[model samples]
Target chain A: MSKKWLSLISMVLAIGMVAVLAVGCGGPAKTDSTEIKIGGDFEITGGVANFGKSTVNGIQLAFKEVNAKGGILGKKIVLVLADNKSEPSEAANAITKLITQDKVVTVLGPVASSNVLAASQIAIDNKIPLLTATATASKVTVGDDGKVKDYIFRACFIDPFQGEVMANFAAKSLKVKTAAIYVDNASDYSKGLAQVFEEKFIKNGGQIVAREAFLAKDTDFKSALTKMKASNPDVIFIPAYYQEVGLIVKQARELGMNTPMIGTDGWDSPKVVEIAGAAALNNTFFSNHYSPEDKDPHVTSFVEAYKKEYGQVPDALAALGYDAALMLIDAIKRANSAEPAKIKDALAQTKNLQVSTGILTLDASHNPVKSAVVIELKDGKQTFKEKINP
Target chain B: MDSSSFLMQFAQQLINGVSLGSIYALIALGYTMVYGTIKLINFAHGDVYMVGAYIGFFATTVLGLGFLPALLLAMVGAGILGMFIERAAYRPLRNAPKIAVLITAIGVSLFLEYGSMLLVTPQPRTFPAVLSSTPIHIGGLIINSQQVLILGVSLFLMVVLTYVVNYTKLGKAMRAVSFDTDTARLMGIDVDKVISYTFAVGSALAAAAGVLVGVYYNSIDPLMGIMPGLKAFVAAVLGGIGVIPGAMLGGVLMGVIEALVSGFISSTFRDAAAFGILIIILLFKPAGLLGKNIREKV
Candidate 1:
């Protein structure tokens, strides 16, 4: 009699698990007309949690400002957040829950390009518009087939633009005749920047003296730096995250290879200075979305407002996050509807929409055409160098 | 590449390899010594190294201690944690099957990793600089002061460990216990105390390596032990498990090979070369470079 009861309980558990899975996977989420739900799939807890937290903070600030002004279409906007854990697989799950369970009209976030790509499929499947703030890889908006992903849009400039900006800066501004490219092979963002930098540098009549790749989480880079030092390039383009970049720069300086090292916005975090030390970062520069030191009234106001809200200066990710939220809210106002299809149409038609970063205009590829700022490191502090317009 | 530059590059990479190998040697000593006495792999040894690094970080940053003090504190802290782990986890499973003990070791490793992760979070912390890293140029090859310090400290510890293992009364008791546990117990040498001493000494050495690695890399994380632990285990096996001198040799060889692979061949295959060497060693010389093959009486 006890054995029969145990088997029956096991059968019930199996059925219950299946039922839970069904409820999780299958759903047309209920729509509440009183408030518009916007999903946020963020990297709230992993390797790039800082980036995720900054982006969410910026998005939340934008929503708070919007809600204070009576929101859009007589409905207050609510942000439903899910932590992606800074992994691509977790990003897919986050987006799935946001769309299938929360029934949000639009989704924002995930700073890394690879994560945006991971979550894009879920949004496309659900026919909900997805806007990424800081994912700059070109393929985020366009698929590999060179077709625009209809349901996907971004608020930041593409990686090609950043690469071209740095390449032109290296050749025309710095007047470096030869360059070296050291990239992180693990990150698509790094590879994307390296490829374009190489092409544009060679096109500008500069030579690439050395090309080396290192995987993420590698602590020792002395051997690779020694190899690069032999070629003796004018500058090194390390298009990797700040974690590895800090070590690479530190080792390179220790090996007496003190040429200017340039990178992209991935080096915006202050931890780079902490790891590499201020002296090693003296001649380094990186392109970013916006500079907190910009004297422009729009930028100044945003910087002051962010400092008031978060009690710290907003980084590039936070600025881009605010811009993305502002763009999405502007589209909702233009479309005069909370429907995802209408929002996507209005987003595609965005023109001269002034944001925290710059005047954002959506291009044919669903990418924002905006200006980028170059920042230089001096004594471990970021200084505004130049702003280049597209 | 010209001959002069080629020679310089070779010399540079050699220095790099030696510095790196010394760190592996420090971790490998713990694995070999623990395996020598108890015959358990003690997979939690690497996590102890990681815990040592955190302790060092806290000692330097929170307690505001200098380099030597922080290093000594971390060594003592990790040593106590090692004893507690052995008592609470391994001692209970002493009479169990080998597989059961190994599984328990893996479980202990996971618990430490996740538990530390919960306390510290998954974010990687930057280790505070305890020493100047200015490079010294000599004969077209650059060597940093930190590298010199690592080599010096590791050598001193190895020498101390060798003297303790070879010339001390406790060393004799340890050898007897390792040879035959029942015989040693019968001879009135408290077998459990000897084993615990082995663990404490080995763990202290690993903690030193952990603190040194944190200084060298300028980064520390809770899960930092997983890869280095496996690599040190490989080093122990390659050097002849349960042998003191062999672990040191195996670790240095592994480090040099990895540096050469990264320098000449490719950085991508560096990790692959380590595991590949393990397979080759197991197939060709299962007794390892210094291990003696003992036939089991069945």
Candidate 2:
């Protein structure tokens, strides 16, 4: 009787272990319910942490609003966020983990153009849809055939458009017949903008009197500024991030080079004022996505909600992030499924979507066709000057 | 090419290079002096320079002090930091292997750099422009007041250091300690005091360099000192490590070479040319330009 009882107990224990093992090894149990999982890789902690954190907050708010409105296709959308540390290799790894580990169908972010370029290849290989929020490099979407890829989309206009807008403004409005460009040789974004701006300005009968280059981390612009001053340009074009831009402007002014300066979207940072004082930035201008003074209801609502959520006014980066999330949700709803191919098709067909920035229509290259706002610096504050549709 | 035009450009480039070279020499003095006495490379020396920049930034921006006062306070604050770093990190490893000390130095460097990043924003800040905005014209070439100030201060410091090392009693004790710590200690000199003083002096020079460069460039960042520090180290090595005047000579030579290469060849190859010169110099003169050959006791 004792032996029979022990055998039965042993058999029960063995069966329980097998059940646990089976559940553990068979992957997550898929509920027969409605839920769509999306992932995001952002540089939440690095040199550009402030921008990344704001972008993440914008995305999360969009997801929350969508879920409150009864999520896409009657399914609640879930977002899984990961930090990429602003490194290209880490961005790729984070995206890989998102797709393989989290089982997310669509991914968003990795904000900087360089990181987006590095990580998008993984999405391409895995056949997952990636909608970048703020990366504006023209090459982000165009392939060897000069066509948009099936898997990648961006919510921002490319660098060429931004470059042309600034060049046109400098030539026509500023009425500068000669200009000099000081570009960050190490940055692809800066190089691209400088190339396009030079090409367009020269074509418009503006002579590039000087073309000087410096490294990204260099702080000293005296020598470069001195060289530029010798060329006697009326205006200078600096297409780099705000950190370097601030120093360059201050150094240029300090060296007695009083040339008016213009820049691209990279100049939209509060740190610019903090670094280069208001005195140095008095006559600066730049091309940006949208101005806070824009009277569009969508933009105003986004501004209010963003201020309420973040306790600060949202910049172009935050607005682009919100728009990217909204557009992705809209695509998911139109496709009615989270399959990569279907979402890509829906994104390719995106049109007339009134985002916070403007009514964005996805061009053939998966870039947005929208208006670029020109902002001028007065007393270290950015004020809306004009808006040009390209 | 006409000799006059070539001479004019060459003179201008030389002045620009020397101004930059003086800043490098000021920072290199810190590295070479510390290595001269301790036989350990303080990798955190660069971060010390970075901290000095921040100190000046805060002193001016937040504390609202005058330029001279801010510079003095920055030097003092950086000196204290150097003392603390030596006490906490290097004091306990006084008897450790040279490699261990080197590793600790690197670790301290990373700690200071990342710590600064966490404390302050990683974005570069534009240093306030207070120096003379006027460019002094010499014939066809022009030089700024900041460059003149940097060159004057660096030369003054080098001369003062040379005087101290050759004449002062404390300087004699330092030299004695560097030559043979045991013998110096046996002869009634406090070796620890000498080493600490060495660090204090080195850190003071680095702080001055940091502040000067900040004013010169009109920008400061947490990671600004790494490349400059490395280049200065290379300059020290090129001039003969542990030799005071050699460091200054090496820095000026390196600077002029870099400027010439960028002006003549390409800016892309400037760094390569500087290092290539170092390699060639080291190949011929292993003891450096001013280094002495000392036989190992073992």
Candidate 3:
């Protein structure tokens, strides 16, 4: 009797889990015949909440457009969104809620790759197709054995390509002979990009002069920056998020080591210029999913419509979110069924899908084989420099 | 590269370490003071520092105050908030179980963190450059004005604290109250007033550290208080809980050791190295470096 609370809580948890599993095992819960449900588990309120919010907005925009032109496959697209609060555990919980409680046919988002990796298994086990908008981690779709997971897919290019694109650009275009790397070893995204870039740069005949590491919480970079200055690398690669990347760029610039810096999509936030100051942002570039400066009509009109809807131009995250939802809808239409398996197969064969970023085509690994854009910063403005095709 | 270059690098790291160490010392002082006075961990003290930084942030960015003035405003704001927290939250749980009071302190901490997050989103704000941070090079050694300012302001605050705790009449009363609260009250000393003064002084020091960090790092956020707060507590314990100089020594040592580890070894194990040293120090000197063994009267 004294252990009643413990037993009761556990029993409730067990029952809830069973109920979820039952729903997963059963075929789709019959809702309105004219409605097809899709779930969104977004990181809408934590460190990467910006990505989540943008993703949700992007999905909403695509859904609204589809609804206006007669819903996909003769069914109204019902998006059931859940905020994961930018936590991994919450992302998993959101997916479970969607599959069991909402009975969604497929899911989208939980943008950051870490969250994607965390929530991927549940969707895999429960047989729900989960499509990520911008998660670039190679391991997100491809298993540790280097095989593609059946149900998990990403709307963006993988990390190797992103790192390769930047390294190639720096070597072949910018003609930088040497580079320094400052990475956040605590973050998988940063570490992944750093390792890939280092490998590819050396392959491209560029020498790594100095390599230093820091944590996400570390505010001081002078020690690392000072050492990097001694080597005098032609370029510095800080493949970290805006929080640390902005500071690194500013400090590096202030230290008079204004070697042109390159970063990944993590640096594609307005906070970068704000933290680093506009003057310090000069001569810095980053590889991203979409460049608003792209003259592509899809990108231009998406920016305009996104501005009208959200009161701001969509960032790389927003563009990817819209693209992911658009493709998912396209898959549903191509499959011509409400079944999850058919949709997954259709998603595998998606080709020449015109989205905001570029023409998206899903490779065998479930990652889009799309071109990546390198945007140059001028007075803190993102200018389209060149697009690297796969 | 060369010996002189190595020496220059060593000196530069030493400066960076000491500059960083001073802020830890400042934040650690608050923890030491609160624990010394009430035997409470005062988990919310770091949040008071966060409050101070935000105060300084608004003062500089919104009110258009200069660096010194903004710092003063931050100190005043945080000092008052510290007193208010002690009166409202901690005071209510004072007569409760020790665990209750400790839990309340943690609650206060989370409330401050999440409340601030709600008020000013979770986005990290760029702290305005109250002082120019352009590195001033000397020989091969590099020093920035912000580093100099951190070292200078921290030393000034520590010195002022040492003076206040050692010489002022309020200092005598605070010491008396901290030694034996019941006895101090029985002897006609204002116990409540002394504790309030202790919280104010301690909070002001933490606030100063907050502003200093905002300037040094050029970034501040609501959740910023958590890590530094825990680290300061560690510094307080490593120095010898309830001892002023012990906290200072512990903080400086921790900062120096961390700087050296990250600079020479690997920054990935920076936190592990810090906690690892703390474990070693505790194993050797259980009462901290400057902590003295006091016989239990009971």
Candidate 4:
């Protein structure tokens, strides 16, 4: 009798474990005709939470604005968000879940290029449209062989354009003779921008005085900064993320090497000032998208509304997220169907799509042909300098 | 690039190394003291340092204390926490096997890291400027004010620690217990109290190091302690695990070497250089730099 009871309990336990497993991975897809589903998997936690949070905020705002005006094709939009927890593997899982379980018509986000590269594979495999607004690496849309992937699309100009914009600004606008390059050696994004900046700066008849490399988590750049000081370049180009940029800037000033600094859009976050302090923010410029200081009606209205809603000025991440959402919703409307393939075709033929960033037009490579803005930092406030046209 | 500048850069790197090593030395003191008294590695010692930084962060940000006061409070709070951990985790495992106690230490380490992450979230916080960061220049040598604080505080703590270990009654009791726990118990000395005091002293020192590091680096996260903790342990081992002065010596040397490698060579080889020192040291001196060999009869 005891042996039979033990067998019965084991059988029940096995079934219960399987049921629990099913609940986690097998969130069944539900199809609804009345509302279109849009999925977003963004890093809401972990190291880069600041970036992801802003992106999610922007996406949420766009969806709210669209819904208030009646969502595409007279059907309400059901926005689904999954937190990637700032990890690539988690991003992969979130994207897969959004596609297979949530059955989102077209997915948007996983903001970093590395993450987009990881999460977009599932969308490509399943033939669903995946769009990114901020992932600047050309590889986000283009394959290893230089062919554009059909399903992958980006609203931001590729890394080459960002590097070229900043290099041009340095040469023509600021008119610096020589520059130094310090890049985050671990990031492909940083390396790509650094490479393009080096090439373009030299092409514009400027010389690179010195080049140094450091990893992402490194706190001490004094030795590298000292080397750069020896070269005595007029401007220092740091194509790195905000977390490292603030420290680098602070350390650079402390080391008595007060070369004017230029960085990429990765320096767009407000936390850079918090990290670097206000004193170090002086005499710095960065290339970015859609400055909130723009006088354009669409830009001002969106910025004002976002400020009213979020209680803070929207950063570049927010602008990108809003644009991606707006464009995706527009594609769904243009397609006039909730079908994934129809939406993909519409996105591929995107033209004159007015986004929060600017008037965006996708080339065959899926990168937007939009202008990049150079912003100068003064007293921790971003002052719009001039826009560089592609 | 040139000869004179190279020499200046070398000197600057040395200064940087000394500042960095002092922070390591501060944490290593706790390891040596705890190991000396209890004969346990106390792997959670690093997390105690991490917790100390968070406490300092709150003290400055929430309570609005000055730098020195926040440092003191953090040290005291961590001391209490270290004793609490001892009574809770280590005390129960006293009579257990040595391996069991070691595993428990590892378990406690994980618990503190993950628990802190869950409570505080795994986001990196900018440590507020406890001290100003104006560079103090002397003959092309740029010294950050925070680095000066680290060197000063570590020196003060080390001197006080030396006095306590050499002159205090509690220090005598600690040495007695370290020499022989069973005999110290028979001699009417409270072994448990001495052990707890050792933990308090060590943990307090580690806490002080944590606050100094946060001020120096301007960033702190839950998992930040893991690498530094392992590095401190290696430093402790290098200087002779239970030897107080040895840990300090080991820490300073490690820092100098790390700075040299990163400054003269590539920053890519910085971590590799640290572990490489450990391998070479272990090969030549298994008992450590200051450790003496004693044969045991079977």
Q: Number of the top candidate by lDDT?
A: 1
lDDT of 1 by residue, A75-171 (tens): 9998999899999999999998888788889999888888999999989988999999988777899999999999999999987788888998899
- Across residues A1-390, which tens digit of lDDT does each residue of candidate 4 receive? 999999999999999999997875566455677788888888888877888889888988988888899876888887788888888899899999888888888888888888999988888999999998789877899999988898999877887788999999999988999999998999988999999999999999999988888888676677667667767899999999988998899888887777789999889877788888888889999998879897778888889989999999898889988988888888888888889999999898889988876788889888889888899999898898887877
Global CA lDDT of candidate 1, please? 0.90
- Looking at model 4, the pairs that clash are none
lDDT score for residue A367 of model 4: 85
Clashing pairs in 3: none
Higher lDDT: candidate 1 or 2?
1
As for DockQ, the candidate ahead, 1 or 4, is 1
Point out the worst 10-residue segment of candidate 3 chain A by lDDT.
A23-32
Model 1: per-residue Cα lDDT over B5-32, one tens digit each: 8788888888989998898899999999
**Chain B TM-score of every predicted model:** 0.97, 0.96, 0.96, 0.96
The local lDDT score (0 to 100) that residue A153 gets in candidate 3 is 88
* Model 2 Cα shift for residue A108 (angstroms): 5.6
- Model 1, chain B only, scores a TM-score of 0.97
Candidate 2 is scored at a TM of 0.78
- Which 10 residues in a row give candidate 2 chain A its minimum summed lDDT? A24-33
Question: Model 2, A102: alpha-carbon shift in Å?
Answer: 12
List TM-scores for all candidates, in order.
0.85, 0.78, 0.81, 0.83
lDDT of 2: 0.84
lDDT tens readout by residue for model 3, A77-125: 9788877888899999989988887888899988888888889999999
| Candidate 2 interface RMSD to the true structure | 4.0
